[model samples]
Target: MDMKRSLLRAGLVLAVALGAGHLMQKLADSRTHTAELATPQPKKIEKVSAGPQAAPAPSPAAPQVALAALTAETPKLPPLTLLPRLPVLAPPAAAKPAPEASVAPDCTPRLSLTATPRAMITLALNAPCAPGQRVVLRHAGLVVAERLDAKGQLSLDLPALDDAGQVSVLFSDASITTASAALPDTPLPRRFAVQWMADDSFQLRAVEAGQHYGDPDNVSTEAPVSARGGYLISLGDPTLDLPMLAQIYTWPADAKTTADPVIEAAVTEVTCGRDLLGETVQSRDGKATVTELTVAMPGCDALGDILVLNNLAGNVTLAAQN
Candidate 1:
């Protein structure tokens, strides 16, 4: 009985072992079949190895230029030639001047000009002390000069000049003395004036010429009418343009034959160009008054170079306008 029991136990254990082995085999086969039916999957990474590469494309060649064709495009130039030589003539020699003496004349100052004593008798020459020294002077007018001393001395020549503007002295040498003088001032311009009173009236008649030309007031007669001295004093260069002035004393109706009251002169009739100004001046004797008239004309050439005076008085001597 003990042996039979042990055998039954061993059989049971072997059967169980056999069943477990079969189940594992089925599971492994099913897994493998499923894997085979699925599609292939790519790997997570790829690697490159040393291998051959594609060849590069060939490059095109550059176009070539021709040397002969380039030379033909250049411009041609003219050929150069040698110039002919010309003869150079020499000039004739000039004549030489003769040699002069080596000695030269002395040029030392010994005299000077002077103006000192205004009196003729006091006149003296200024020079180095030489008791018997000779002195000289030259002038158009008569004069006298003499030497005085070695230093300062005052002297003058007699009858300096006929002209008021001139004063001259003579000397042997100009360097012996020196002098100075103040020239006189220029005088005011001179002119004459003609006048007419408020009661007087007249028209421009005709021009008067020469001395004693015509009456100042009467132009109806038309006799010789012209200009004369001091009638119209030229203010400018009278020869070119007659710009003049005048001073005329008004006269009373009865003054010609009898004593008339002293009165102021009224310059009315004036011709030079046109009226410039009018003023009053004292009479020469200072006893009465006078009129100083200044006037201007269109032009001396424009007015026939003549002034026609017409007024109440009979025609008077004509005076040229400036």
Candidate 2:
């Protein structure tokens, strides 16, 4: 029983010793905590001012430090070099204005007039710039329209109305050329022309002292040149669009010759039922007289008949015979 009691006492003592050691450890931890609390730690203290704070001064080496940092981080580059300036050239002299196009020597028309036999004037025209151009020929009071040849040339004989012959050519562009010629002094036969617009409506007939009314010896275009006392010459081309028709009658200028010139109208289909209008130009005693006339035609029933108009041309009598 004593041994049991001793063993029990030993267990109780071990328990008390363990409890005391636990209490001492807890006391030591408490003291350490309290000591740490009692000691003062270093703390940053900030001043709270009521006014605006001044900006801090910049560091002396800040720029150099930043420059060094930038130089280290950036890659090395070649040194810059400026290219040589190019010479400025004066703008090329204003290109000499191209010489104005020269005018052709033959551009202007050339006109010439020459006296010819039988009191006629020869008209010559050279218009290199106006090939095949229609032009109006004006002489005294007479006017005629004709076209130039392919080579811009024209040559024609025109009866001289005046001793001092002056002719003018008018182009469609309103440009005109003029020329004059002196006619010969030789005496010309008494002549006259009957002009009309109709192609074949009018006929000029001259009855000489030895000729009958319908005889072949009467002066007509178809009569033989020598058989008839007077001669008839037809002028103008009937093929033109507006053909100008003229029938010229010439008689001897001698005082002994007596002649009766008449204008006859044929009653063809073209003039059967229409009136004909015409003009007469007579060159007598170195003077020209122009007269307008209108002849009444017979109806269609008289298609084959011929009407003689007496007053159209007066009787030709020399001054010495009169």
State the lDDT of candidate 1 residue by residue for 146-220, as single tens digits: 343444233443212211223333334544332323212322112112322222211223222221323453212
What would the TM-scores of all predictions be?
0.17, 0.59
- Give candidate 2's error at residue 201 in angstroms: 3.6
lDDT computed for candidate 1: 0.34
In terms of lDDT, the best-performing candidate is 2
lDDT of 2 by residue, 206-301 (tens): 877776667867777877243434666666555557766677777754558877777778787888777788877787655677777677777888
Candidate 1 error regions (>4 Å): 1-14, 41-322
What's the residue-level lDDT of 65 in candidate 1?
Answer: 81
Question: What residue runs in model 2 are displaced by over 4 Å at the alpha carbon?
Answer: 1-105, 198-200, 227-229, 311-322
